[model samples]
Target: MNEVFARGPSLLTRLCIVLMLSVGAMVIDTKVDNLSTLRTYLTSLVSPLQYIADLPGGLLDWSASRFNSRQKMLEENSRLTNQITLMNEKLQRFVVLEDENNNLRELLDAPVREGMYRMIAELMAVDNNPYSHQIVINKGAIHGVYEGQPVLDDTGVVGQIVEVGTTNSRVLLISDITHAIPVRISRNNIRMIASGSGSLNELSLNHVVHSGDIQEGDLLISSGLGNIFPAGYPVATIINIVRDESLPFASITAKPSAQLDRIKYLLLLWPPDIAPVDALSPSDELTREGS
Candidate 1:
């Protein structure tokens, strides 16, 4: 134990030895090529250790780059999705506008008799009561629309206004069960009453004699007798004629000329005597009403 604890050299002696060894190593490294070869071998041996020491930094940088690339990709995907949704909404709006334009053009081209004033009206709401076939229009008394005013479409008569408000009015469709119009057969001028059959596509002709000259293909026009509807407008077409000798009148069914189920726009007309002097144009009235 004493030998293990004994000091081999004094502190000054050790310092002198270390200093002389360091000076000799420096002289050899500068003058002789032997130390250079040894240093090359030492560096070669330590190359793997140097790489191992830097591995964590290299791996961290690689992972950070991969994470950034993925984040950028996700952001791009989100932006593209939003853009696509916006484009689709715009496309749908264009389609609706195109349909509205076509409907307006057709309403403008409908036949109008001389001395009659006409204006366009759009449907606002439809009556959901199954018992009544009625619709609401954007025109009202404020716009010179009155109760009993005739309503029509591009093809023919639709109905008449029954109720009026300041900004809107109710129209009773010709297909309503309580509605009736005097019609004349275009072929032989025979007059008959075309009444609604409570169906959008059917009307009943009342009191038709079995021997009447009416046929299945005959066209019916307003006879201008009741003073409710104008003359020469198409009302309905005779589709079926059932003669029951057991009954007094023949059962006849006709299809209305107006597309009552699909109409979006309507025409309101005023006779020359009843035309309003202060009535605005259809376009101007619509803009004002909307605002």
Candidate 2:
């Protein structure tokens, strides 16, 4: 131990020398600011190291705060959860309102039929029968919905109401096998019957001869023959035509213009002769009498 101490400066002497050197450096820095640039450079170089060294302490402090406050954390989580639920509900309502707005805009842009009054109705239920194309609407006799009343969308005729209850009505789609409409060729005004083929996308033009003027891509419009559907509304387009000498009638198929299976809202039309008369309540009658 004595030989090692003699080789280097004693521990007390080394400590005194370091203390004196530190005091001299601090006095020079305070008196003349000579070490300012050096101090700034050194701090800039050591800043990254200082941050790295403090990282563990900072992490420990963060963990203590984060895991220790169980009740407070639960309360904050619940508050955030409630806010999310409220936002979701608002988003749903916004979606519904946006759809309704679009439907109304389409209605406003549609051509108005002369002498026909229109009322909007919503679909309530769809018929599950794969063989039938029918839908039930929320409107009924109470809302002046009657049998044979025509149902139309923004594009064209959808169908006619076949059954009416007190608060609901059933509509037979134009694609139903039993349904038929008088449609005229929009190209030449040649009138014919368009019968449904029980297929959602197809209609049949019955009795069309081989020499008939109908051709593929010819548009069919309502001819207003049966007084059920109005004239000038688009109905279907001829998609296929097959003619054979053995068959008396040419086989013609048309695709409907209206999206019958995808429609969500419908318009119910009232003919001039079937205009609804509002039932007067007792108060309304008494007020009318007084007036």
Clashing pairs in 1: none
Model 2 ranges with Cα > 4 A deviation: 1-113, 277-291
lDDT of 1 by residue, 1-291 (tens): 988767599789999999999999899899998889899999999999999999999999999999999999997765554344333322422423443455458788776544345666778999999999999999887778888888877667799999999989999999999999999876667999999989999999999999998899898878778888876677888999999999998999999988999977677778867666544333232222221
The lDDT of each candidate is 0.79, 0.77
Each model's TM-score, in the order given?
A: 0.57, 0.56
Model 1, poorest ten-residue lDDT window?
282-291
Which number leads on TM-score? 1
